[model samples]
Target: RSGEAAHSGSSGELVRVQSGHGHFVHLVYDTTPAHVISELRPSVWVRADRPGIQFLVRVVFPHVANPRTGKPVTRLLAGSTYTQQGSWQQLRVDDLPKLVQAAVRPMRSQLGSHIDVREPYLDRLVLNLYAGAGTTRIAIDDLDLPSAVAVGNATEMAGRAAQKRGPAESPARRRVELAGNVLQVDGQPFFPRMVEYQGESLNFLKGLGFNVVRLSGAPSDALLEEAKRAEMWLVCPPPVLKDEPADDAQDRPMVFDARYEPVLAWHFGQGLTSRNLEAVRRWVEQVRRADEDAARPLVCDPADDLAQYCRTINFGGILMLHRYLLGTSFEMADFGTWLRTRPRLGLAGMPVWATIETQYSRELCEQISLLSSGRAPEPAASLEQLQLMVQAALAAGVRGLCFASRSPLDAQDPATRARAMMLALINIELHAIRSWIAVGNVTPEIKAANTEGVNPGITGGVLQAGHARLLLPLWTGTGAQYVPDQLAGNLITFVVPGAPEDNTVYEVTVGGLRSLDRKRSVGGMHVVDDEFGPTSLVLLTNGIAVSAMNSGLPGAGQRAAQIERDLTAYRLARVQEIDRQLARVA
Candidate 1:
């Protein structure tokens, strides 16, 4: 209906939308010829014919950076507070910049996303009117939104141009392939024990038994030399974005040059929220295009906990799951069945690495929101939780393990030293059975007795390594890091398939392998009565330890021998250090 407009130059017919069932209607306006939002606010005049009628103003920005994670965000909401019934009233938001910054944090918490929020490019302004029941009409005009000097807006052309990827003219020395959830590099099964690079001595981290280190960016020649000397691999990180999504994907193929031999894989989307998932697809398409030979498999952190949505996601070959809340009963409903739904997630043949990282609980996120307004969230996780976290992920089918927390292993904090030692121990243990993890058939389900020694909290899986099978049983404890002492003495059942009565079972700890009391139960099941605590054991393995190398990879045995030699020394040193840290912390 043509009606008188609000106080403006021309009194012409205004636009209107009909409503039904108290629906939300939005009137969107393109924010072209807009300013940089330095010191401006939006105002609108709204006239309501009914008492319950409400109106709101929202503006969307294409590139509001989440300061902590350094990713862009979109959308802002504001409204009027005047209560004069049925009269024209003006609504304004004075603190637009501050609101933009503070608003993103709660969304991060609500979404359980690990994004950190900055420079905002306000894209569009919208006039929102919530209509009441039985057709309530509201008129809104003079929607003066964030007016200032014109600013340059980013276009999509340059972003798309950037995605063309770098030239790969250099001679490719080796090929990287994914063979049924195992990473095959240079024709060898590569089971990575990874950690974030924190400026620690390269030899120090290597001595701690880490096979791969995720670098901040492309590795320098000197850093490459150090990695080569340490017999370790380096993972390159993706370029950070500052604008629109598509063309933003265009720059940098992650590595400086395609010929960098030490550059093992490219790391993608760490500390990103689910909001930026679309960005991930664009990034992957660009990066995957760059790695034409597919010699460099991407190690992806698939957007923190994506339980909120069941969208199919893409990855850089390997799936590095950030199941940080494993020890705490955070009840990640997605993760509760996440590993079970792996194949359904189109991850049937992809290698998966789970992170112990920091056990980020809801309380911790709340505290970070309420108490601190700074970077660096206080560490809420403990060593005991980290120990159990390792157990749970390993017991599942994680071929690799990463300390995704920034500077976790190298920090001088007392707890951090203990964490480093604990991780070192686990790294050494994983190294001990690297082949089994790298190529063994992962059976994430092992039968456990309902009564007798086994309890409900006890769950584990089997890894069939040629002549022997490894049984890993872990105690998935409560959210508060407290557990009954009896959880340590839980019983686990393993099947000795086609084995004679003389078949022997062995228990593996971080220290070494040992013989345990094996009792046979019904159906050829050997019930092992042992203490399965949070801070002990690699797994239970049958004797003859790994049958003839089932690894068809050429020279797999020789490579394993070399890795084993280094791992044994690291394990010995770490176990000894664990004792020292234990005494020191005590």
Candidate 2:
């Protein structure tokens, strides 16, 4: 919603607002800094048709910025107010300079009340009231701008202004950044084994091998503390105005909130849908002022691969891909086409990640019909199918991975642990070869072939990591096979061109990597052969990565005597912690 006011409209002086999700209404007097001779004492009568409607009076000056810190300056001078059960409540911010100064550094260049014309020359005062989910009718009277008047069609002007405005730019050199196509965290290559938090213990998730957790809404203090204790990163939502106020001594939105170290990135936007894309863009423009100097990158939600509308929407810098194909109605070639042209998307050296989960599955199109008929689903994806999907997303060239949201694959169902355990094991595998997987580039020179003729489904690709070549052979299963049957004992030969004969080759598998036997083809290509099953992972790396796996992985018969001695103690401590909880459901 634009807070830019139309000096006069057919609606006369009373500006009525109909606001909802992705919508806002406001009163504004857009003026040049020369005309800004202190009408900052903003007072307005706010009344909803219904009582108890929450309202806010934020004085927005879109073009305003602090001269000292180079941060955008927006005001919540008039704290928050409520419509008194259909009665009018006059909200006012008496000492505008005090509250505004308290919230931000003075934009007046020097101290005192003198306005500086040299720095960010604009004084467009906006009295904005945003909506929650549903629409609310708000009536405003007694527009109080001494130097100017409120625009009647402020909302209309805002929509247009937001359209003209490109997405906000975030400061560079974030905690998470990109080196080539690889994601670097604090100057180190980072492969985030991320899973959407689904009411699981933070310690449990950390122990299970997830380094990053996703939260749909703003996390609580306890949750942040727990994540810190668990030593995990978070993909979280931006803190809302409802939680923190401007008057609080210890709390400040722009500066203090920037210190949330556990937060890796902020996610916003309407996910895969485009109905509210414009409104979301507008909201981003206004909300970005609160996080002007914030460091972390912002990511959009459920980015639509079909429409790719999220590319047009502003999410700071980081944009995610949403082309999910391994599940129902998998299309290898069409999906691969998009992945291949990804680098040309002009991300400007920013790291790109993909949401590889059931949240954007084609099957949802049938059950929920969120997608078009062109994006169809037939056979369901099984566990083996999932394994191949992971291999494809990484091998096809995605930097990092965020696991499914509200997905059974991401869920840790106490009753059903097989799928969760398998995913955890896959995370373990991804972490092992992350050295190459994070920064490797896909090349057509590397190839894999089955001994028993060419298996159309079981194929592989080579990753050209610096000085090291990694090969991932996936049995993706061709034809109408949704979940293909296991093909065991068949030998697959992988050939990597232009590698030395004495390359230290290793095979990365679930939980660890093992040294593999390498042979040279008659044509002088590096070749490694291994027998694998349907769900088996065949990842071979040549001469770069070190083997971290112990050779002491015991067989089933010898495993009983080698179980961890602290298993029982750990279990007892866990049970005690559960019992000590405030609300024990049991």
Candidate 3:
């Protein structure tokens, strides 16, 4: 019977039924005009409002007219009896083969176990809701049976199929070494200033001073050769396999023993299926045989068992954790330290890499909306904010920095252009100081007496790279009720209270460098305004100081012009070097 269903009733009609033997109601859907069954999952929302009722829900797929005989045949799809009462339930019949087998028990012996059920034909989907002996009621509403291709499942199936196809040729393996927080390729210190871009123009990346390109999956052989010629390294993840269960026995428990603990952990933790584990095994073997020298590590998120498993297999890859800028400085520091101190589940220590997105945080995004009231608010990551995040990670001693986003690097849009410029500037500085930054150990907390009156938000640390020690002072504009103007001109001091009689100290700023006298103070202390603009300041006794000599320093007109000329010459030399490398590859 059709009527308005109670319990938050609406104008829509609902199927009302009384509990009795052979008392049933069904809705038939035709798949003749369009082959709807071939594309979409036929589903209906059912509600058993009355308690203490027993019902059997069966989805029937009647046979279509045989193309040769033009006769209608009987075909059973799926049937299930329900007793428990619940809220609105979604009954979806997507697994047609399994459902068909469960429905037709008598034909099981004749058709055998592996019958192909993908044939597209005119059929009828009949949803039968039957009530058992009891005083009960059922309502059916919101039936969304459509005729279209199942894009989601199709895409997944395609990906699984692709994983079965191995690379045509073996990849050449490269030697990768990690020594004390630094990664070296072929015995040379390799600082990965990477960019995630899909563009083919390596020239842009070269000009931006990036040394690595990170791809989601394996690159083509041609692309690999091109990257080799460009003097850049490629980082890619292993192919993901389908997730199939370890065993098909329904009676067995899902848990595994300690020997299978790693697999089980990976299966549940990383959401890997048995099929995926098999694929990973195959991919690892292929990498081991074909490209022993390549740094083809199986990249994964931070998980103990997963890390242990990879290490056990001698997979040399880094654990990349994203979404860094969302937390407070202390929280970030704690996370970084935790990552560094985690037990080495692998044979060798794995590098900890953190990702930074060049966009506003979710909270900030929502706040923008609330603050704007109705109008659209401008969303962005200020240059100062980006610098704060990168420095924090560096201070935490991350081996690699992974810049992530799908935003087009070559786009003409303003936001994209701004983000690209910010990345380039940051990378330029990193590329310049990578030698010092790569080897330096991060001193999480620096105890200096002179920094008492500095901005409370300002934090300082020292990076000890060899005999030279560089000071890193950072200020994240967090926990302040109001933005202080003085923050833009905050002063950071590095105090060495002992008599370093012969050591020379230089205050390095973005604009240029200036020398400091050792005898000026009791021992020696160098002070400089924490230039909170587009540049960073480092107090160092050694290494080349990076500066914007051409733009902002005073009394450096002639010096700035000379530096500009030198930069022009350097750019030209880089272009010529690229040409030379490309020619050699050709």
Better of 1 and 3 by lDDT: 1
* Candidate 2 structure quality by residue, lDDT tens digits, 1-586: 2222222332323334543111123456655332222454545556665433232335444333333223444443443345474666766545444455444443342223443222122244455544332245666555554444344443443344343334463322235654555666756677777887877777666645678988888788888878767778888777753334468865644442534667777666425455656655554554466655544566665433423433443344566666556444655433444555654544445456766653335455465444544433233344455555676677677777877755434243331243454455566556556766778877763445666656545566677666667676655445312445554545666666766676666654442445566678765454545665543444444422443222212111111111121233434664676676635555
Q: Pick the candidate with the highest lDDT.
A: 1
Q: What alpha-carbon RMSD in Å does predicted model 2 have with respect to the real structure?
A: 24.0
Quote the positional error of residue 259 for candidate 2 in Å. 6.0
Question: How much lDDT does each candidate structure score?
Answer: 0.55, 0.52, 0.48
lDDT of 2 at 321: 66
**Candidate 3 overall lDDT versus native:** 0.48
TM-score for candidate 2 = 0.54
Write candidate 3's Cα lDDT for 233-286 as tens digits.
Answer: 666653243233346565332222111111100111133334455555655554
Write down the lDDT that model 1 would get: 0.55
- RMSD each, Å: 27.3, 24.0, 28.0
Model 3: per-residue Cα lDDT at residue 118: 39
Candidate 1, residue 502: lDDT: 60
How many steric overlaps are in each model, in order? 14, 4, 8
Q: Any runs in candidate 3 off by more than 4 Å, and if so which? A: 1-175, 239-286, 293-298, 303-315, 324-349, 361-378, 448-455, 476-491, 496-501, 516-535, 542-586
